[model samples]
Target: MTALAAEAVRHDRELVARHAYGDPEAFDEVYARFSGLVFQIARRMSGDDALAEDLSQEIFLRIFRHLRGYQGRSSLKTWVYRVAINCCRSRLARRSRRERAFVAVEEGRLERVPSAAEGPQGRLRRREAAETVGRALNRLPLAFREAVVLRDVCGLSYEEIATVAGVRLGTVRSRIARGRDRLRLELERGSS
Candidate 1:
């Protein structure tokens, strides 16, 4: 790791140690650092604003409750993401595939307020593109979807994804490749 990265890992360890020791401000610091990342991952993975909000809360609750067991085996960011992804996967697994599909379909119907700068046509185009991507992601197998979303949406390194997903590095690469291929096919089918 670079000097900066090593510093970050050390800092993460100290923060976790503080939180585990009941430092009043440590958890708040943790929340301030990770809340946006957690929420964005939830939103992109779940594709529903309201559900994302709920998942964000649940993720933090899990983080708050389980903060003590964190051994600092990985970067705190990686550990937190692992927890967030696992939580999302569990919630999604409980719903029937048909239910997930229905929700994904319904997601496209929700409206958003457009930026004044974008104008109506720009807003329409942006919405359509987002729907297309979301639909394609939803159609992907869980493993592939998780890998692709982690890599593309969450911007994690390949090694980081392998750690978070508990898979081999090769497995992560294969999943991302296959997932992108499937996503490309889906988008092409949609466009044509």
Candidate 2:
């Protein structure tokens, strides 16, 4: 096996052992491993970096608190993702009721773009496309957005996604199909 793959397997075993033994350090390892995944899901769902950071922290806190209750029905990673998604959903619901604007950037002069190893023009186009996609994702309905983010961005299988979203497998598949179709239409419209 590849070195990275071997390392991942070792880490997974270590985490399970530590968690099962109630080792706090083992929980910290779990947090370090999955924190980025949590943050990205939170950021995508909330469309606000600050909110995402807060939600990521909250998810980790919940995971630490509930680690003992985890029954190992699903993978530990999937359980953590479920917690993150639920936390993001709760924050979204609260923010929707309050009608808060989730601006991604502050009002100021344009920031310097990253140095483009692919060339300036290609980089500009790529950046514009990314921004458009981000906006389109943010415009989607919360359920659809979460489906796409978990499936596409996080690369979760339909079964894993179903577990994370607390939905049936069929529902997860339908939502992902519809979400991709909607996003395609939005992108086509924007391009045209």
Best by TM-score: 1
Error of 1 at 46 (Å): 0.8
Clashes of 1: 0
Which pairs of residues collide in model 1?
none
What would the TM-score be for candidate 1 when compared with the true structure?
A: 0.82
Steric collisions counted per model: 0, 0
Assess each prediction's global lDDT (C-alpha) against the native. 0.83, 0.78
- Distance from true location, Cα of 115 in model 1, Å: 22
Per-residue alpha-carbon lDDT of candidate 2 for residues 1-192, written as tens digits (9 for 90 to 100): 578756755666667768878787888788788888988898889888998888888988888777767765666687788888888888888886666354323212222333335565876867876666776787677889999999888999998899889999999989999998987776766555
Model 2: worst 10 consecutive residues (lDDT sum):
104-113
Local accuracy of candidate 1 as per-residue lDDT tens digits, 1-192: 889888988898888889888997999999999999999888878777898999999999999988888886777899999999999999877753548667666544433333335765987777767766775676677789899999998899999999999999999999999999987766665555
Highest lDDT: give the candidate number.
1
Displacement of the residue 153 alpha carbon in candidate 1, Å: 0.9
Positional deviation of 24 in candidate 1, in angstroms? Answer: 2.6
The deviation in Å at residue 191 for candidate 1 is: 1.4
Q: List the residue pairs that clash in candidate 2.
A: none
